[model samples]
Target: MQSSSFLAAILFFISAAFASDSVHKYQPDDAVDLWVNKVGPFRNPQETYNYYSLPFCHPSGDAAHKRRGLGEVLGGNELIDSQIDIKFQKPVGKTTICEIELDEAQVMQFKEAIDRDYLFEFFMDDLPLWGYVGDFHSKRKGDNQHMLFTHKSITVKYNKNHIIEVRLTQQNPKPLEVGRKLDMTYSVRWIPTNITFARRFDVYLDYPFFESQIHWFSIYNSLMMMFLAGLVSTILMRTLRNDYAKYAREDDDLETLERDASEESGWKLVHGDVFRTPFSIALLSALVGTGAQLAMLILLVILFAPVGMLYIGRGAIVTTFIVCYAFTSFISGYVSGGMYSQHGGKNWIKSMILTASLFPFMCFGIGFILNTVAIFYGSLAAIPFGTMVVVFVIWAFVSFPLALLGSVVGRNWSGAPNNPCRIKTIPRPIPEKNWYLKPSVVSIVGGLLPFGSVSIEMYFVFTSFWNYRVYYTYGFMLLIFLILLIVTVCVTIIGTYFLLNVENYHWQWTSFCSAASTSVYVFLYSIYYYCMKTTMSGFFQTSFYFGHTLMFCLGLGILCGATGYLGSNLFVRRIYRNIKCD
Candidate 1:
C-alpha cells in the first residue's frame, strides 16, 4: 500500500509541472538608448484622512516616460488592478533568470501619453495600507532585498514558462546634466535571477499597489511595524504603569522642585513631569521625530514644487529634509511658544531656537555619515559632495529665510488669536488623589502606544531600505492602512478606558497620558531595532538615524491620537481649572 501511494504522488508531481502556466514567452522589443522627452508641470492630488496619492501620480504633471514617471496614474479607490508585459526567449531546452536594477549616473527621462495615461492602478481589496516607497536600487525580479522601507517576506511565486519585457525610460534629476542619458531601461533585468533560477527572468513592474499586484515583502514590513510598536507599548505601559506612576509622583526632591518652578503649563500634572517621562519614551520621541520631519517634507514638496512629482525619488531625500525642516521649525517655534507659555516654560526665544536647530543638527550628522559611506564604497548613485554642499547652501540660503519668515508670522498669529476658553489665574491646586493620571501624562502615554504598534513594521522597513529592495505591494498595504486606522482607534480607546478606570474621578489629567505612552513605546522599539537589527555605526550615524526615525513615530502618534488628547484637555481645563467648588 505504501509503494502504491508513493508512485501516485510521483505521478501527480510530474503532471503539475507540465500543467503550470503564468508567464508568456516572447523577446523584448528594441531597447532605446537616447530619447529627448519634454517635461511639464505637475498638479496636486486630493488629500484625505484615509488616503494619499501614489508617487508616480504626485505633482500631477506631463513629461517623458522616463526620469521617474512620465504618465502618472490618476485617482482611484485605494488599490486598482495594474499590469506589465514580460517577454523573453530562451533556447527551448534552457532557462533564463531576471533581476531588478538601479545603477546609472543620471536620472531616466521620458514623455507622457496625454489622456491615454493609465500608468498603473491597484484595487486595495481590504488590505491595510501605510505608504509607498520606490527606490531604483533593486532592478532584478528576484536577487534583491528590501533596502530601507521593505519587509522580510519578499519571495515572489509564479508558474514559469515564457517571458515578456516590461520596459520604461530613465534619466537624470532634470535640469542637471553632465551625466549619461537614460533610455528605455527595463525595470527588472533577468541576470542575477538568471543565476538563481537557471537564467529564467520573470519580469516585475516596481510599483506599490494592492489586489493582484501586491508584493509580499512590502506588506509584511508595514504590518510588522505596527504590531511590534503596539505590542511593546502594551507590555511596558501595562506592566510598568505603577513604576512610572511612582517615578512621576515620588518624593524625589529634585524632580518635584523642578516641576514646580521651571514649568507652568498643566504639564506639572502630566504623567508626573517631562523628567518623569520614562527614559524609554524620551528616546523614542527623539528618534521618531526625524522620520516625522522626513514624511512631512516629502508630502509638502510633492504638493508644492513644480517638478516634485517626477523628482520625488532617490536623490530627493535631501530636498525633502531642507523643505520639511524649514517648515517644521515654524511649527515648532509656534507650538512650543504656545505650549511652553501655557506650561510656563519661560524663554520662548530659546524654545524656538531649540525646535529649529534640533532636526537640522540631526540631518547634517546623518547626511555626513551616509555621504562618507557612499564615498568609501564608490556607489555610483551616491549623493555628490558638490550636491551636498549645494543642498546645504540651498537650505541655509533659501529655506532658512523662509523658516524665519514663517516663525515671525506664527508668533504674531499666536498672540493675535483669541483663546476659545478664558484663562483664569489663581492658586487652585487639586487635592491629592490616586485615581486620575495627569492629562499631559495621559496624552504622552497615548502617543507612545501608536509608536509601539508601528515599530515592528520598522524591522522590515529598515532592512528593505538598507539592503536595497523594491517594496511594491499595494494590496497588503491597503490592508495595513485599514488595520492601522482600526488598531490605532482601538488602542486609543483601550488606553483612555484604563486611564478613566484608574481615576474615574479625574478623567482630565489621565486622558492625555494614555496617548503619550505610544510615543514612549516607539522610542523603546527604535532602541531595540538599532541594538538588535541595524549595523549602523558612529555617534553621528546612530544619533541621526534615531533622530529622524523618532520624527515619523512622533508625527504618527500625534496624528492618530490628537482628537482624544486635545478634547480631553479642553474638557479638564474648562471644567476643573476654575470650577466653583469651594
Candidate 2:
C-alpha cells in the first residue's frame, strides 16, 4: 500500500507539470484575468521584490492570488490578481483604478523607486508586460526631480482566441510631493493579429544576436582543435606501440636486456609507482564521483529541454536541475565507492559521507551568504524557509538513500583493484626536471585549448542569465558540451604523458588540475564580461554576480577534472597493459 501510494503521488506530480503547458482557448466576452507579478530595478535582473512591496493601492477585501508551481515559487514569482475588469474581445478606456493620498512616507517611497529605475511586471493570458514605476526629470537648475506615473495603458494583441502579445505604457507623470492627491487610471485595448499561438514567443527571442557569424566561427574553431587533438592522440599511440615492442621482446639475451633496461629512461621506469595511491584518496574519489554525476545531470537536462520546452516556463530549468541532481546522486556514490576501494582505502564511511555532502554543503554555504544579503535588502531573491525545507526533504529522503544504496552496491561489484602493474612497497622518488616539465606548469598550460573550445558559448549563456535574454539554443549548447569533453580528455592525456616521461609517478592530481584549470580562465573571462558588457551597479548586484559565477566555475571544474582524470587513467592502463611489470 505504501509503495502504491508513492507511485500515485509521482504520477500526480508528473501530470501536474505537463498540465501547466496545456494550451488555453477562450471565447468572446470571457473574463480576462490580469496578474501582477514582480517589481525590481531594471539593471539587476535577479534583484526582485513582490509587486505589492511598494506603496501601491491594494485590492479591497481578500484579493485573489495565483497558485504557483514549485518552479514558479522558486523563481521568486508571487503573482496576485490585480482585480481589474476585462473581457477577452472587449476593450475598456480610461478607467480609474484607485485614488492615492500621497503623504510624506508615500512621496519618499516613490522618489526612491524612481531614483532606482524600478520596473513592474504584469501578466495577461501568460503574456508579460513591463513598465517603469516612475521617472526622473532634470531641471535647468541642475536639480533632479522624481515623478510618479499614475496611468497604465495596456495593449493586448490576439490571434483568434489566443493572446499573442501584451504591451504596457506608463504615462501622466506627476512630481512626488506630500499632500498630493494622485489618481491611478488604466486603459485596456484589444487588437486582432494573424500570428499563431506557437509563434507568440518569437518577439522575445534575439535571433540575430544568438545566431551571429561569430557563433558559427567559434564552432568551426572548436572543430579544428578537435582535429588537432585527434592527430596528437594518433602520434602518441604510435610511439606507445614502438615502446611496447621494444620492452616486450623475448628473443634478447640477458646482457642485451640489461643494457636496454639501463637505457630505458622515460615512462616505463615508473610503471610500479604510477598506480600508487594518491594523497587524500577519499576526497579525490568523492570529487570525481560528484563530477561524474554533474556531467550526467547536464547532459540529461540538455537532452530534455528542447523536447519539453523548459525555457517557456518560469523557473522550470532550475526545478528540473534540482530534481535530476537528486536522482543522479547514486552515480556519485557508486563512482566514489568503487574508486576509493580500488585505491585500497580502508574508511568507506568517510568516502561515502564526503561523496554525499561535499558538493551540497559547498552550494549551501554560498546560498546562505546570498540569501542573507537578499533578506537584508528585502528582495524576493531570498529563498523562503518553506522552499528551503522542501529542498532539504527531497535531498534527505530521496537523494541520500539512493546514494547510500549505490555505494554499497558499487563496493561489492567493482571495488577490486585492476591496475596494469602492481604497486611497489617502497615509494619512488621523483627526480628534478625542466621548468616546463613541472606538474604546476603542465597543469596551468594544459587548460588553454579546453577553455578556448567553449568560451564563445559562455558569452551566450551569460547573456541569457544576466541580461534577461531568452536562451533557446540548446542544440548549440549540446554541440559545445561534446566538444569541450573531447578537448579536455585529449589535453589532459597529453599532459599526463609528459609528466610520466619525466619519471613523475604523481600524475593523478596533475591531470585533474590540468583540465580543471579551465574554470580559472572562465572565471577571469566572467570578470571581463561583467566590466565590459553590463551596466549593473551597487554592492548587492556585484556580490550576487561573483558569487553565482564562483559556484558555476566550481561545478565546471569538477566536471572537467573528472573527464581528464578518467581519460588519462585509460591511456595509462592501455599503454602499460602490453609491457610486463616483472
Candidate 3:
C-alpha cells in the first residue's frame, strides 16, 4: 500500500506539472516557476482536487473531502476560491515558485470524487495577526537538497495585486504541496515588518485603532493613576518648568516653553498623591501588563506555532494565564510606583503594597470560585487549590512587604524638590447632591458604558478559547478591537470632561474612573451573558469558565480603565495648558 501510494503521488505530480507548465508565463515566465500542486480530502480513496481559504472548516456530516460542486464553487459569493496563496519572493537555491490560478469550479469538475472534510482552523486568541497564511514549504529540488528558507526571502504585502512575485537566482523547480488542507504556512524567510500593510496613508482599518489605543492607554493612564499619589504631574512639571513664574497671552507660546522646559527638568512626570488614589495603581498595573502580555502571546503564536507550545492543545490557556498573571505583577509595580513618584507621593511602600495586592485578590478570588465549580464537576483541575494558596501567600507575604520596604526607602531617601504649583486655594463650601448623582459615583458609572458594548461579544470569545473551537475570525476581531479602543477613549474623555465641570474636581483620580467605573458594569453584563448564553457543566467546564472567561472580561475592564484615564488626563492638560501654575 505504501509503495502504491508513493508511486501514485509521483504520477500525480508529473501530471500536474505537465498540464500547468504548458500554460503561458504570464509575467516574465522564466523569472518565476510553478513548483507544486497537491490535492486533499485525504480520506477519500479516489484522488481529487480542491482549494479553500484556511480557517476553512471541516465539513459537517459525511461530506468530508468532497470537491466543492462546480456550480457552487464557481458561483460568485459562494466561497469559490478557498486557497492559501504562497507567493514566492526569491526562489531558494534552484527552486522556483509561482501561482497556478484556475477556476476552482473547473478544477473540482475535472477531478475524481473524494471526501471534503479535511481542514485546519486558524486562531487569534493565542496569536497575533498574520498578513496572510498560506500552505507551502520550500527546498532545493536539484543538486544538494539544501534548506532554501534563508537569504532568498521576500516581503509579504497584503491587499496588493495578483501578480505576487518572488525574486531568486532564477531556477526551475519540481511540483509539490506543503499542506494537505487549505492552510497557509509561511516560511521564516518571509518578512512582515518591511512591507507596509498600508499605502498612501491608510492601514487595515484595524491598525489605526490598535496604535491609538496602545499609545493612549500607556500615556494618559500613567497621568490619571498619579492622582491618588496626589501630585498633578503636569503641575509638578510646570513648577519645575517655570521656576521663575511668567504669564503668557497665547497658548502656543506657553505650550512651547513648557514642553522644552519639561524635557530639561529631568523629573519624571509621575509622582506624589497619585499613588494614594484607590484602585488606580492596582488596576492600571493590570491593564498595562495585560496589554504587554497579550502582545507576547501573539508573537509566541506566530513565531512558534509549528513548534507546538502556544496553541498546541487544551492546556494553552493555562500557560497564557500564568504568563498574564506574572506580567501583571511587574506592570502593577512599575506603573503604580512611577505615578506615585510623579505625584511626589511619599508612600512608595504603600503604593507598591496596593499595586501588588489589589488585582491579585480580586482576580484570584473570582478565579477561585469558578475553579471550585470546575473541580466539583470532575474535569480538569481549576488551578490546583494549593497553587491558589501559594499565589496569595506570595502576594501578601512577599509582594506586599517589598512594597512597604520600597516605600520606607523612598521616604528616607529624599523630599519633593522645592516646588510650588501655587494655586491659591479657592475655598467654597460645596453644595451636596444625591449620592447616585455625585460626580465621583456618577463618573464611575459613566465609565462602564463601553464595557456594556463589549460584554455580548466577549462571551463567544472566551467560550471558543476554552472549548477548543478554532477561532478564525481574528481579522474581524482585530476590527472589533479597533472600535472598542475608540469607544474606550471616547468614554474616558467624556467622563473626565463632565467631572471637571463639577466642583469636586478634587477627586480627579477617577479619570481612570471612566474605565474603572465600567468594571462594575462588566461584572453585571457577564452575569447576564452567562445566564443567557451558556449551559456549562462540570468542574472542568466551570474552572475553564473562570480561568479563561473572567480573566478576559476583567482584563477588558482594566483596559477600559487605562484608556479612559489616559484620555481624561490629556483633556485636562489641553484645557489647563494656559492656566497659571506657579
Better by lDDT, candidate 3 or 1: 3
- Candidate 2 lDDT, tens digit per residue, 257-301? 776765557788898999999999999999898989999999999
For candidate 1, the per-residue lDDT at 280 reads 29
Best by lDDT: 2
Q: Candidate 1, residues 1-582: lDDT per residue as tens digits?
A: 999999999997765444322112222341212122111111111111111121122212332232221112111122222222222321111222121223232112211111111122111111111222222233467542222121111112222332222232222222212342222111333321222332222132233421222245445654665676567557744644554354445335556746665333332233222112122222222223323344355445435443342222333444454546655644444443444344434454554555455556655666466556534533222355555566567667755555454445555565342333333343234444343354455556555444544454455455444433333332343455455544554455545444433433344234334554555676777787778765555443454456556665555444444334444444334323332211
Clashing pairs in 2: none
Quantify all predictions' global Cα lDDT against the true fold: 0.38, 0.88, 0.41
TM-score of each: 0.42, 0.93, 0.44
Off by over 4 Å in 1: 1-313, 316-330, 340-346, 369-385, 416-464, 471-582
lDDT of each residue in 6-49, candidate 3, tens digit only:
99999987755533322311222122222211222323111212
Question: At residue 362, what lDDT does model 1 achieve?
Answer: 56
In model 3, where do residues sit more than 4 Å from their true spots?
1-309, 324-329, 369-379, 382-428, 432-437, 452-456, 466-468, 507-509, 537-551
Best by TM-score: 2
